[model samples]
Target: MYGVSTYALHSLPLPAALEQIAELTDYVEVMDDGCHYIESAEPLLSYDLRYSIHAPSRSVNIASTLEPIREASVRVIEDCFSIAAEVDADVVVHPGYFAWAADRERAKRQFARSLAHLSAAAEERSVRYAVENMAWEFFFLQTPDELPLPDGAGFALDVGHAHIMGCLPAFLQVPIDHIHIHDNDGTADTHSAIGSGTIDFAAVMATVGQNGITPVIEVEGIDAVRSSISAIRPYL
Candidate 1:
């Protein structure tokens, strides 16, 4: 099945974005953030849609060495997961970054501790949590080899980020349960429409098709979302 993330309509209010998404596709990954939030899930329950959530991460740093910051991050994400249960949604989360002034190794350990907590929390709620790869210069999970999640957790592979980092093939090597599909120039995470950038969606889709993995298009506009859907339709 194919879905579109509300990320494409991030500028719109949650209700309006959900309305548009309902018209475009039956599946939507509601990005729980500023313009889109889990609090708006009540309206979503009325729609015949399969839902997922891109957990809020703007100020959330699960890898922070400070105990308070890390705990706050977990609470924010857990709140998102709590809402996920009400709407029968899975969640995708950013793995986290090491504090710029902190010890990288120790921060990584802290990050792992956070993932373990989230993994148990997700299982308890009967929702799967998939950690996403980041495109930042010093974040964990930039590649598949960097272990981010414990057993019973999954990976949310962002194809655009992988292409920008020249790690699409490497990221594909990991076990993935969810995907964020979009395009970007090799230089940046522009979230362009499919075929508007250099990444090889054909090969990507071929692999996704064979594996029976569904992807949620994560572009930034309705036209881009529609274009991406058309571009990937042949494989489906």
Candidate 2:
């Protein structure tokens, strides 16, 4: 089955977005930021659908060189884990970025430490998390060559991000625990409808089938989400 992300209706209130998305798919990945920031599991209990959370990434940087910021980032995600546990939802997390090219090594060390802490936190909560490969050069884990993930962390592949990084083909060969599907011109992260961009959804769907995973349709608007669902249905 395919899933949809609240990113498509991020302008709406969380409850309202979830209500509308429920009409489209039984699986939903809540983009836990902006209007949908999940403070608790209370808002999610009303839904009969399956869930996965795209953890709050804005202002969160597990790779910060500053000790306090790194600690705070881990805590933010730990808070997200607590809610995910209640909903039995796996979370998607961005691998943090470095501020400067010179700080890359230090940032890598910090990210490793954060992952170790998050692993323990997630284990305690009985929830899983997948560290997503990023779209930009400053972010860590932009390619499969960066594996194996530390602390037994799972991989959440964003096909659009991979395409922008020009590594989608390599990513498809790796084992993916979760996936976010969207199309974009090779240059920008537009999150367009499936058929409107350059990504070959046929190959993407073939990999999804082989991996036995549900691909979350993470487009920009409700209309695009609907189009993407229709575009992808043939492969399902």
Candidate 3:
């Protein structure tokens, strides 16, 4: 699954966007970070492109302390599902982010409830629900053992984020059905291409092998993203 985040394809016409990366990859993630295909596929989305949707993020966390923001998160995910259905893509969702880590306990409860809502909506749309683990967040799908992840609930691991949080061990343990591959400086989320940072790329691959998991790289822009894939190709 050599998929690049379409956030990398920002602002280009849909056909031009698809043509730009067509030769380098096969799958794509329709990130709400930049592009909007609300009215039509333009041209690229018109193709039989395999897709995955990264839900709207940033301050749109489902675990917000405020009720309105939390509800908004659900509607946002619902919109993502509608788009996924249009593109025939699976959906990748972040349960939501908390502004402060202290709210983690309450956020956990909120996430559980939110997931239930998302799960039902997703099931109806036939969209896959992949919850992502973050680099700096209140809590992760903290443990694989904790959740009642029905038949379809899966995980999207962010490897560089794992290294940042110093959760390498736990990161290796989760059932990785999907991933957000990127690199970051220890101090911040740099989103640099793989091998540009201090992470042990080979060790990360070995861990993936050990766990029988395959994770796609989460990157920005096509040129840099293509390079990152090459850098990690040997291990992959």
Candidate 4:
């Protein structure tokens, strides 16, 4: 029912994107630091955009074999949480990634440790955050049977990523609080419109309806994102 993810138009510069947010939507997802730095400024900027933070995706990792990277990941999330505090936003973050490593147990441990650290940081500031189910990543929380979620944790069901992860229903079984709806091809992750790709919209929407989860569909550019929102408007 809400508009598209602002991350769809992330290629734009921060100020330009802020201007677009000023013109286009009310609930803007401040998906990266560029947006955060602008939105988190003091003296109250002119923008009326209500925000939610999505943690940045970079070379940093919470599930890293190196302690420094893990520490860096924690620091990055702390920065995100700080920005959330500044904007009074709910921060959303992917737990961690384990690429090229087939070690599930090690990944699980790293994710747990990272969540534990960030969870404390989030609570100290009383800023809310959600754990997202990422595609083809090393996080155990993607699949239901893979890892256990912490008590205070929430879920973000990325539909496109779920298709790639092969765990939509399993993820649904968990107590989902929010959803990241998108479409993509079977082999590659393309954030397309709902019906434009291979994802089953009817079944997924049905499952979401049955479970009472509302979705925020993600897409590419502003026009395509608007079209996807229009397409799903009737159902919502």
Tens-place lDDT digits, model 3, residues 20-99: 66676777666665444543434436666677767777547777767788888888888778777777777777756566
How should the candidates be ordered by TM-score, best one leading?
2, 1, 4, 3
Cα misplacement distance, residue 26 of candidate 3 (Å): 1.6
lDDT of 3 at 222: 74
Which one wins on TM-score?
2
Against the true structure, what is each candidate's TM-score? 0.95, 0.98, 0.83, 0.86
lDDT of 2 at 56: 91
Cα error of candidate 2 at position 216, Å: 0.3
- Candidate 2: where is the Cα deviation over 4 Å? none
Quantify all predictions' global Cα lDDT against the true fold. Answer: 0.86, 0.94, 0.70, 0.70
Off by over 4 Å in 4: 33-45, 99-103, 137-139, 206-214
Report the candidate with higher TM-score, 1 versus 3: 1
Residue by residue across 1-236, what tens digits does model 4's lDDT show? 46446677678866566576556567667567443344344422456766676777554577776678888988888887887887787777777766656665676677788888888998899888788777664555556665457747667777787788777666666666667777777667788777777877777777677768556656777777677776676666
Instruction: Please say which candidate is ahead in TM-score: 2 or 4.
Output: 2
Give the top-scoring candidate (lDDT): 2
Clashing pairs in 1: none
Question: What is the lDDT for 132 in model 2?
Answer: 94
Model 1, span 1-236: residue lDDT tens: 79999888899888899899889889988988887866646867878899989999888999888889998999899888889988989899988887575579888888888988898888888988888988887788887777546766688889988998898987776667889889988899999999899988877887687667788999989999999888988878
Q: Which candidate would rank higher by lDDT, 2 or 4?
A: 2
